[model samples]
Target: MTPFTIETNQYLTQETQGFYHTDFGGVNLPNNPNYLYKLKNDPHHNWSDDWIRQSQEQLYRVLLIDLPEVQNHIGKNPLTICVVPRAKADNTYNPNQLLFKAGVRNAIITLGNSFIDGTNYIQRHTNTKTTHLRQPIDGYNNDGSNPYVGITNATCNISNNVVGKDVLLIDDIYTRTVNIDEDAIQALISKGAKSVSFYAIGKTVFNH
Candidate 1:
């Protein structure tokens, strides 16, 4: 299996046991009001200042720039953002085709997956996998294959619908060895997608 490559290791620069830090409230931001636009989060973890900056920076580098190579391979159609297991807090802030709004292009697709999502399937049990590292707001591997519980590609609308759309998917991490994101990509191809790429801010050290 082809392992995911690692780019910047600033996340590894520090001696952090995990990607997140303590919740020190009142953190300063870049003065942009709508900075926190589209994020798939867990209900339990608060959006701490450090968490926001790290995630945003990583997306900027990987999602926006690094994966342009993918576009070269697959003709650009439009961006389709799919969120699996939408955070309870951002319940009303569901996503849309906001690639244009986010200054990308006139093509974008945004959707969310709640508890029974087929997109991203987390497999590890809480204590063993440590994915639920951030309690209450647990993140999982989107690689489940079981028809009932596994990550089902059919669940993502874009999977079978996109014909030649150059895709960029933004999420929090890379967990699975041969996991759900790949499943979603295949699903997109089935949907007629030209290409699909992924980006995430923090990945588990052991996931390497």
Candidate 2:
């Protein structure tokens, strides 16, 4: 599969780089029922749990094949993989809520020593507004004022193990508006990570 480079901005930092596997057209949009979208939202669409599992299994296969492409960009040795936490707090998630991270966990297990499994290296302890739900409130604007503003240190815990380590932060999808991936990048760096690179299974492509 071909990879796309994530564009950097003021908040994202030029020093850190990001990559993603495919383009996503979002849930309500037609012509793009991409794998990551389905895995993330099948339950809301009334699809069976089996469908969710199949989507996750499919992503597991892709991660095994495509993550190495992202690895090629990480100049550091022995990188640890950290996943961006979901909307709900970690302990509050059900099996459905756990799908994305589960896929990452499985991929790390198969990848062996090249990638360290630090999926839970950053843990969300507070619930945040789910971005896809499209609520009227803007999560990005009032960031410091509210815990639900987005993925920020106010709602998450970064592991001490990240100190002096090269981290590859992974997310199911990367959307510019919400900037969840960017926030995760900031959280990791603020925790003293030596370097941080990002990877998303899919990136939102509006015009596509």
Candidate 3:
């Protein structure tokens, strides 16, 4: 499938572009055969190991076939592969949550030096209310600051190594109102990244 752009505004210095492989999450709950949804919701430890492994293989396949074009679009410079931190504190992931991250690591190994593996480049230091469970009025923190900014400031820590590097940020899903991806792109740019591109495994398709 052809990739689609996720960045929709001029919020950054460069016109950053993001692409996703499939559609997920619509008014029709579960959305039949939503592979991305299945990949994310299925845990590596507590769930069916077979399903998770198969899902990860699918992810690796997509990345192997798709990422080359993404690299070409960004020019010949090797792009740093960065994974968006999960919603909770980094320490919470004792055995490493996020099977998606593991898939990314596998893909990077297969791709070799064509991509720089900075998957853990952005680390979360504190926990934030999971975005999906938020109330309508939960857009800001108790301090009245923009929640995205506050969340990034209080929880996120960018590596000094990202300074002056071109980054390709990865996430499992992209939904418009939940601007976590948008905030992350801004965070990377602000941290002296020469540029940043985004890629989501799936983009939420609103069925209203």
Could you give candidate 2's per-residue lDDT for residues 125-198 as a string of tens digits?
Answer: 87776666555443333222232233578888889999999999998877775667777787788889988888
lDDT of 3: 0.71
Instruction: List model 1 lDDT by residue over 1-208, tens digit each.
Output: 1125423231221111111111212225332222333233324435565665554454444434433444443334344444333222122333431221232221121221211122322112211122323333335442323322223333322433345554454444455442444454444445564554554433434442
lDDT of 3 by residue, 127-202 (tens): 7666653354434342222445435646789887889998889887777767677778888888888888888777
lDDT of each: 0.35, 0.74, 0.71
Name the candidate that leads on lDDT.
Answer: 2
Judge candidate 3 at residue 134 and give its lDDT.
35
TM-score (C-alpha) between model 2 and the true structure:
0.82
Q: Which ranges of candidate 2 are over 4 A from the true structure? A: 1-10, 13-15, 27-33, 41-43, 135-151
TM-score per candidate, in order?
0.41, 0.82, 0.80
lDDT order of candidates, best first? Answer: 2, 3, 1
- Given candidate 1, what's the lDDT at residue 137? 31
State residue 20's C-alpha deviation in candidate 2, in Å.
0.9
What TM value does model 1 have? 0.41
Best by TM-score: 2
Lowest summed lDDT across 10 adjacent residues in model 2 is found at 140-149
- What does candidate 3 score on TM? 0.80
Better of 1 and 2 by lDDT: 2
